[model samples]
Target: MSKTVFITGTSSGIGRETALYFSENRWNVIATMRHPESRKTGLEGRKNIDVIHLDVLDPDSIQQAVTHALTTYGSIDAVVNNAGYAAFGPFEASTPEAVRRQFHTNVEGLMDVTRALIPVFRRQGHGTIVNVTSMAGRMTFPLYSLYNSTKWAVEGFSEAVAFELRPFNIKVKIIEPGIINTSFYDRSKDVLSTKEITAYDTLVEKIIRYEEGNIKKGKFSPPSVVARTIYKAATDGSWKLRYHTGKYSGTILGLRRVLPERTFIGMMRYLTLR
Candidate 1:
């Protein structure tokens, strides 16, 4: 029987690419997103793929999606937690509501999805969990306080859970992708701001200009790169924990580890504002 993968946030970007990749590789794919009837990803009507509605913020939807996948496929080999959004800008500029939403969607949502699938995975006696985080999980940049915190939370959570899940023949993998060319650069990004906060305007402007300059020069990898990496992580069958993908992921991770804290902060400031 063909292996099955349940992936969240499959409406576009890495999620959509991963769903397609799995389908092409002959794996049954449960490609779920918040809006199934409103997406243009063409995941629907594809062989070996089922597009379903799954909003990470909706607990009932998470359960329903998992149930549907298990019912249709008998067992799921892996679950990819790819549903998340980023809130960027100064910490002070981020409203309490935005902060809550960021953590709820990126951190709690991932946990909720994983929690729902753990029982099924435990019952099946084997499974893989691939969490889609960003390089920001380990390496922080300016104007992404909330976003970085959320990814970092996923990183820590995945690391800690891997130990417990290993005995059940389940593997937890973290996909730390670097800058990728996707809707995340625009549509998926929430630029946090309030009318009262003009203090961060200059700093945020500098960071945005610097980042945009690099983006225009094509310094990022395509979403397919991360998708392919995810496929490898899910099927590698090793206890390996972290899989870095996309442009500059490995290099940046290395820098973050070896550089002094003060020096690293300076370097990031230079790279993000220069």
Candidate 2:
């Protein structure tokens, strides 16, 4: 009786790796993406994997994917909400529409998918929900204010829901990873600053350039690292409410918790300038 897990955003990166890893470990995987017809390179002919169409933005699509997974596997033991995008720029430079898009995909979309799946889990009497938040949710960084805000909302939402769902034996967990070697930084949406704010153009450009360079240098951990952490959280019985999955995430988060506010801000500023 292998458990079934439904994962969103399987088009690439962490979602794809998690699907592959769980399938390899003898679990049924419902791998979903927004554009199922896209000519993607991963998840080709995996025996235990079923690729499905799921657009988190659309309630109908979410329902269809959940129904399909239940029919294919007979039951779903976990749902991983991994489908989201990143928007990088100064908060003042970001447009209202850009902020809405971030909340739509990261916050509202996640809630929609979870709400769609809750009834199914309730019927089954036991299940898990794993949210893929970032270290940015806990700490602020330059040019990522809105993106961080969305993740922070996710962190809060997941925490509050965990308490409510405990009576039903439904577990909620948050996976917080530091910068990973994903296309997130490269493919993030950009909201151009108004020309009126011309004074900060050079500073903003330098920050953006540095971020791009860091991503290209491949200093972040592989997607498999996150995939493994997610797999453990999904299957293991001793599930904690939160997991810090990358090398630096725990250390930095711990520092933020214990260090003085001014000291933490100073360290962050030094890192940003570096």
Tens digits of lDDT, candidate 2, 138-240: 8988877888899999999999999988888999999999878776766545555657777667768878777777677866888899999998898787649
lDDT score of residue 205 within candidate 2: 81
Runs in model 1 deviating more than 4 A are: none
Best-fitting candidate, measured by lDDT? 1
Candidate 2: residue 200 lDDT (0-100): 67
Candidate 1, residues 1-274, lDDT tens digits: the string is 8999999999989999999999999999999999998787888898899999999999999999988998898999999999888888889887889999999999999999999999999999999999999889998888888999999999999999998999999999999999888888789999876568888888888988877887999998999999999999999888899999999899989888999988888988787776
TM-score of 2: 0.94
* Distance from true location, Cα of 110 in model 2, Å: 0.5
Pairs that clash in candidate 2: none
Show where candidate 2 strays beyond 4 Å.
191-196
lDDT of each: 0.92, 0.86
Q: TM-scores of the models, in the given order? A: 0.98, 0.94
